[model samples]
Target chain A: MRTNLMMTAAAGAILATGMTTAAMADGHATDLTLCWAAWDPANSLIELSKDFEEQSGHTMNFEFVPWTSFADRMLNELNSGGQLCDLMIGDSQWIGGGAENGHYVKLNDFFDANGITMDDFLPATVTGYAEWPKNTPNYYALPAYADVVGWTYRKDWFERPELQVEFMDTYGRALDVPANLAELKDIAEFFQGRDIDGTTVYGAAIYTERGSEGITMGVTNVLYNYGFEYENPDQPYDIDGFVNSAGAVEGLQFYKDLYDVGTPPGSSNWYMGENIDAYRSGQVAMQMNFAFIWPGVEADENVGGGNSGYFPNPAGPAGQFAQLGGQGISVVAYSEKQDAALEYIQWFAQPEVQQRWWDLGGASALRAVVEDPDFATSQPYAQTFLDSMAIVKDFWAEPAYADLLIPMQERMHNFVIAGDGTAQEALDGLVRDWIEVFEDEGKI
Target chain B: MTYSPIDRAAAKTPDGVARRIRGLSDRTIAWIFVAPTIFLLLAVNIFPLIWTIRLSFTNFRVNRPNNAVEWVGLRNYERILTDPDVWNTMQATAHFLIWTITLQVLIGFTLAYLINKKFRGNDLWTTIIVFPMMLSPAVVGNFWTFLYQPQIGLFNYVVAFFTGVDPASFSMIGDVHLAPWAIVIADTWMWTPFVMLICLAGLRSIPDSIYEAAECDRASKWRQFWTITIPMALPFLMLAVLFRGIENFKMFDLVVQLTGGGPGNTTTLTSIDLKREAFEKWRTGYSSAYAVILFVTVFGLASIYVKALNKVKER
Candidate 1:
């Protein structure tokens, strides 16, 4: 009874101490909310924020939503001028919309005042995720995470002696990581319906999700390699020849061929999550997915470690480039706690913290962090990541980016999956749609 | 108006709060009690509808609120009316609506008829049949994506097991020709039970004396079913059809989760397209116009349908 009384007393003291600490935090600390997609990196950010909270006497509230609904939820928050999110790790595509509409606070002054130079980050990321008018140095947000669409293949399956011999005999080449779009197509076909260890596997699992930006994101990787520009640099919105170029049509057709003949059954309408699931389940021989998926793939028991091979997107006829996939960190303009938000950004930019962030599974956009000599050997797929980031391009970041995106998504999906028309016809329709949207926006 | 005796007595009562409460007439008290509901209706429903209609007249993009909201009267409506893609979505919505309703009505009424008869384990079977409707449509759509997986999904495996065909030979959601039907099948599966329940209610409500009189007239069971049972259940079945019709007309989540309006624009229903324009594209004015068009279509059709339904009831 005496011991029980002592224990009760200790518990009461602990509870009192907790309440006192919380009350102190509530009084002294500024509560700031940071919003981003609920991906693996968000957990790393959560773990990394403890130091920020402890040092700055500020509480970090996080609003991590699923990738599917992240844009809708966050954009609605920004559009309505809600103060719920003080900071947002917005999609790279949103830079134009976020910047132009005053949804995001201009970060040029913050970077200047805080000694955060744009040159410290990778050029591709700054251009893709931060800049609004394409090549302009007008800073809006700091490139928070740098990523690119790359391929992960079954290295074990490719290295099998009998399989290699069969592939060599059939295609007159040894099976290896594809160096071009044609070779990738061939490899995908070779593994399309083949059995490995008595388990039936499909070719590659590529993105074909129609409702949003999935198919467009996936197809742009190939389209960029085939020299498909959004529009002519000299003549904007004069996209008839540029968007529906012979090479672009061929590239689109190639993608459709791969999807129509190579991918697994019921693989239509797949996006990031489905691609990861397919790879992890050993249902597909290859997966064309964003670098965000690499960590999870690398850790999966069936497909991770030395079992998989990583490579940047293969070159097409014109050139090679991977579609950029990343986000920028910006302070919301309406945020009452903008000062605290800037402070968090400044803390996040420190080299040591970036290094620790990388350690905690974040793909930092800092050149200093990513270009370290040891960074290449830090993880198995790190070298491929570095190479892929070397040749990265982004989609239209126009403030009216969605208006530009949705029609293309529809046209591409209609042609590629639905077989509604020829690739040329689809691109023709897309150009018409894009021209109308641009006219509506009074951009052209 | 003269006060009632009760109100006069309460107004003279000693308690102040009680006197105040009792001083109100029935109509005033009713208004006071329902004021919150009225406010909420105005806030959530009436105001948005008005705002949506107002926005439908302008060239305003939701994402670009700072930009000038141009007065382009009827332009937005004119564009939406002429847009081929919008019409395609309408056709898809209509196709989904007709097929799902037909299948649901047929299957639902059949199930209801079977269950209306005495059975050893009728309650258990009814509960099992109704289980799918209780699930969240999003969750059901997601799991159906798995179940429709050609390689590893149970749906194809079951089909293969019964048909002696490879599971990978055909893709339900991936095939353009099959995707619309896939959505139809899923909607039918989830909502047939709702129709069945309505039908069951209809069957149970049919006065047994009529059947007894039919028996007295030496009418066969089949003849009585054709003449008496169906005629009695017709109103309930029609009610179920109207509810399902409206719901399926705005079908977004399940079909979206299942096919994402894909295998191309084959399944791109109007709601998904409107959502894409409004939220995804942030073409607020254009989408508002689209919304107004859809509202008019559904409202007009429903009004006509209700009038017909009332006529049936009167008959």
Candidate 2:
């Protein structure tokens, strides 16, 4: 009787485990996880997800990695088939790799099924964040955030009567918001090293970080404005003449000149944080950074409110442009709860949710939300952000984007910061590196 | 009445369970106890290393793992061996290893010798000297960047005060010529105390009777130092050198924090280059070959050094 009882108990336990697994696999309530960089915007996003949780009855979990390690950590999770993330806010450059690797759920069908239309998003954002095999209409993500390179300058310094007269005398132009790169350089030169209120201040702080992709991102702003194209549109991967053109070389030289003479001491390794610190500490006359930091800069005690002014990236020889900076939201393909994740995206795409996203400090990629007349007047830098987004270009989002970015970073940093060799030579070497990598990938 | 915790725990165990444990042979128990550790070692260390070695012979990529992993025997090795960039990194590693080890051993041994004198407040001085080593290297490496700043850094201000040169005229981390030495200085500052602690132990281990006998022989203080102290402390000094040499070779975090092998790759060590290739560039096979070469170089050199250390200890 005891033996019979033991066998009966064992069979019941196995059957119960099977039934529970089946129950969970059926349409039961589930927990969904979202991952993103640990930034101010991520906090706003988490706050916004509460409503979704309440209605869906699925508690939303978040894994926020610091920006420095965000790519490394999240990509590792996706590549290793980890189920830690149901939703991901991936960088714009990650769309190609994520889509190609099947790490992200292809969202075209989902969007169609849910009445979500790509025509609603800004054109640039759709091309930048949502498209895979870029310029193609295949959607793998929803454009969640949009940002671009822009400038913030000390308005009080430019408005000083004596300084304004001196700048005019020196550069034959009034001290005001620069209309082009030449005027920007002139203003930077004028303020390179001057005493202000018993403190010696330097000129502008620009990106020059060496370890990662700081210089490439910053220099590309100037490069794009000066006619630097990654490849001939007709012939892909042919970067020889386009990337190393005489105009591109001049632009790179101009950046190098600014870095050498205008920047503060130890500015050779400055990036976003360093630029923010320099601007906030009243150590610099101007700072070039992304729009995300503008809110913080305007709220700063030292140089904020009417004391600071913001503008789009000044034009170069060929035309004006800014490097794109933003990310898109995608559902991880490996997630078991992709339906719930897709539901979250649909809810997030609502116009009301988008308006709240912007109001809560998250940059909105939706045209309807940002184009609201009240939105431009919302903050001091909002108009500048809208203007900058109009002429934005993005870096390559190829699956092997790192292979392309690392060489440019190394070459640009070596020339710009280290002051080694000419811009022509650096660009040539970069072309060689790109071609070699492309050949290895069987792309050539 | 006098039940210890272990005894009480054993007493509480069921008789059948206790009897079963006791029935196992000592060898069997030892094997059971050792099994988990061996398994962990194989899982963590040996398995990954073997996998890396196998992948080193293939044309593979971490990011492109779905693609076919083509076997190109010795091609990855060939490229790494012939690459000038790899050579540059090796040169940098050698420079850092040599200077840091030499400086640390010299400075650490001298301080250890002084502290071993049993002077007043010796313990306090030891604690003060050992303080820098106790702080996190990441923190030290980061703050050192500020300290090396040309304009507002105290380091530059102090240098200006002494040398009468303008602080804003130069930057330690920004200049390629000075960046390597800047890293050398930062690493030495953080690690010299570790060597000093080891040397201090060596110093205290020497019996006082030997010095007393030397004094009876009418040996002068300087002579005694050369004949007795130097020889006796040699083994410990070598140990410290070996430890520091191995450490500075694989130096990643501190240099990354300090210079990031920057100012035009002036300070890019092998480990930094390897990391860039592996994680940053995602060149798994190429970086694996690089890693294998570095492992062989370090392991072979360390094996020989260990043999020498053993000989010194025997003496």
Writing each residue's lDDT as its tens digit, candidate 2 over A1-444 gives: 335435644554454344345435664557889999887788888898886665555678999997667787888898888899999999899998999988999999889986789888889999999999888889999999898999999999999999988888887888999999988988888888899999999989999988877888899999998889999989998888998988899999999998887899898787888899999999999999988888787777889878999999999989999999999999999999897788789777767677778888889898778877687899988899999999999999988888888888889988998888999999998889999989998989
**In model 1, what are the clashing residue pairs, if there are any?**
none
Fnat values, one per model, are 0.91, 0.65
Q: What is the alpha-carbon RMSD of candidate 2 to the true structure?
A: 9.3
Position B32, candidate 1: lDDT: 89
Q: Assess the local accuracy of residue B267 in candidate 2 as a C-alpha lDDT between 0 and 100.
A: 86
Q: Candidate 2, DockQ to 2 decimals?
A: 0.55
Runs in model 2 deviating more than 4 A are A1-29, B1-35
Candidates 1 onward: DockQ, in order: 0.70, 0.55
Clashing pairs counted in every model: 0, 0
